[model samples]
Target: MTDILPLAQLGRRIMVTGPTNAGKSTLTVALADKLGVPAYHVDLFRHLPHTDWEPRPTEDFHALHAAAIAEPEWVMDGNYSEILPQRLARATGIVVVDAPLLSRYVRYFKRTLQRQRVGALEGGKDSIKWDMIHWLWHTRGTAEAHRKLASETGLPAVFCRDQRDVAALCAAWDLRLSLS
Candidate 1:
């Protein structure tokens, strides 16, 4: 008899949630690349046109997510509380990436710098300002709250405390698939 692998049994829908600059998008992209599935950034649905900070219609967000979930396989990344229930219902797995406040701050700063320097962000405009960074750190309380809610949801969640943990989880997933 041979042992079977767990990842071989994984379902298609997945959600990646985390604090700001915790690398949720990076993780989603990596997973999608590995799994050969589509990955959706919820921010793209939430952001309004020509405005970096302005939000789109909440109903539109819900509808967009609903449509995405209709797909057979997808990796959704974001921390939109209003759509949590719908996402949770459709997600086969949840990955929560967490890091210290200082670490998140550093990551956000570096990402902003990189995006600004590369002129790759929306509208070919750099929206990250010192005040925005300050506001991000100040408003981190919301991410913490979402983390708690996710924890309480009792989903089959993998919480990564830092980058090492994230790497380990990815390695484990790969190993399990290879063994299978």
Candidate 2:
């Protein structure tokens, strides 16, 4: 039997992990607002703000990620797997967004074509790239790894498998979309 935990049960330090364009950031913000905790977007720590998807130095990004996890309460969004162990150690629960690959591709292209995307780095421009298309193609199987990690750590996990699942969860939690 599948166990689907309620949003409130995810606790204060929730880790929202998923492939790019899978709505992880949006869910993180909603969870944070519902829980009255800070929301952290891992992309912000990994990339320099106000730039065209430029990455920060590896050490600098690691430092920022460490600091964010050290916070007492937060809902973090992203799947930086290299440093995932440390984050998982501090996380109380996990939310894994497993939207369909077609949906992900559509979201990626739509965001890139739009003037301003919700999760794009502040002041960073969104653009379509062959590399990103390749990345999207390889996003498969990531949600399973995320779920396995949560299981190993004995942390409960909630999975949003599609837009309908997301909507149901949000409604059940009484969560309001901040910016959608």
Off by over 4 Å in 1: 1-6, 49-53, 116-124, 139-148, 175-180
- What are the per-residue Cα lDDT tens digits for candidate 1 across 13-85? 7788878667777777777767889978887777764565567788887788789988889888887777878
Q: Over the stretch 1-180, how does candidate 2's per-residue lDDT look in tens digits?
A: 135677667778999887778888888888888899999999899999888788999999999999999999999998887888899999999888878888888877877787545567888876788988999888765767766766678788887777788888887788876543
TM-score (C-alpha) between model 1 and the true structure: 0.77
Cα displacement (Å) at residue 34, model 2: 1.1
Root-mean-square deviation per candidate: 6.0, 1.7
Per-residue error (Å), model 1, residue 143: 6.5
Candidate 2 ranges beyond 4 A from true positions: 178-180
Top candidate on lDDT is 2
Where does candidate 2 clash, by residue pair?
Answer: none
